[model samples]
Target: MVRLRWYRAAPPPDLPVRQVHGFLFAPDGRAFLRVDGARHGLPGGKRELEDADPAATLRRETWEEVTLEIGAPRYLGYQLVVDGGTHRYAQVRMVALITRIHPVAPDLDNGRTYRRLLVDPRRVGDLLGWGRRGSRQAAAARQRAVVEFALPTLDLPPDGEV
Candidate 1:
């Protein structure tokens, strides 16, 4: 069985970080989601060797994948993925502000341009279908976004136009 335990703290140093993915919020208080075919997921990926840190990894990945830029990232926590009672590795998560959005282009790494969706943070859990865990992370991202980026609480139009 696979288990994901959310933590508000960083994983132990001994645990190798296999991946880094998280919420990337925009100035308008909407979070970014990458849509590849029908799968909806956050905008992040594996750590590259030249990445100075986790935040660096996020910055580089976002640009490489979608040509978007982000501000300083605030570490939220990680989802320690466990399988069959064996600890695998930590997937670090964070919340950051979108600074700039460049023209859409093929990702340098994969050569595929994903459909980027700037959705309401309130709907992220539903979009990702992560249930309770996703809902909690969405809430945390909203709170951190307001504090870290000085973004207002998520306020969408009644007609749901972002």
Candidate 2:
């Protein structure tokens, strides 16, 4: 089984980072979701050679997957992923306070445009189905967004609509 543990620590220098992804919020405080078939997820992917850093990785992946250009990302935390204790790596989580959603286009990697959704903060964890841990991560990111970016967290419909 795969286990994920969240830490509000900086990205590890020694561990191999498998991916970078996280809570991407717009100026209005709505969270961004990438709709794959029926499952909803946050934007992110593995590091690329051209990416300058983890933040750059998130920016490039977000744009590729959702055709959205995100502003400077705020580092939040990292997830320690253990697959049966045999393998381990880090997945960085961050938050982007501003974005410009462009006209939908196919992802550069897959050539298929994914459906994008802007969601309310309250339902992000439920949508992701990552249990309590993801909920806590979302809460932390929301808190950071509020304190650092002045994003009005949860000012959305009760149904978690944008």
Which stretches of model 2 miss by more than 4 angstroms?
A: 154-162
Alpha-carbon TM-score of each model against the true structure: 0.91, 0.91
lDDT by residue (tens digit), candidate 2, 1-162? 998899999856888887999798777777778888898888899998888899999988988888888778989999999999889899999998655768888889989778877778777888888899999998888888878778775556333322
Model 1 bad stretches (over 4 Å): 157-162
Backbone clash count for every predicted candidate, in the order shown = 0, 0
Instruction: Report every candidate's CA lDDT.
Output: 0.83, 0.83
Q: How accurate is candidate 1 locally (lDDT)?
A: 0.83
Give the per-residue lDDT of model 1 (tens digit) for 55-85.
9999988898888898888999998899788
lDDT of 2 at 156: 62
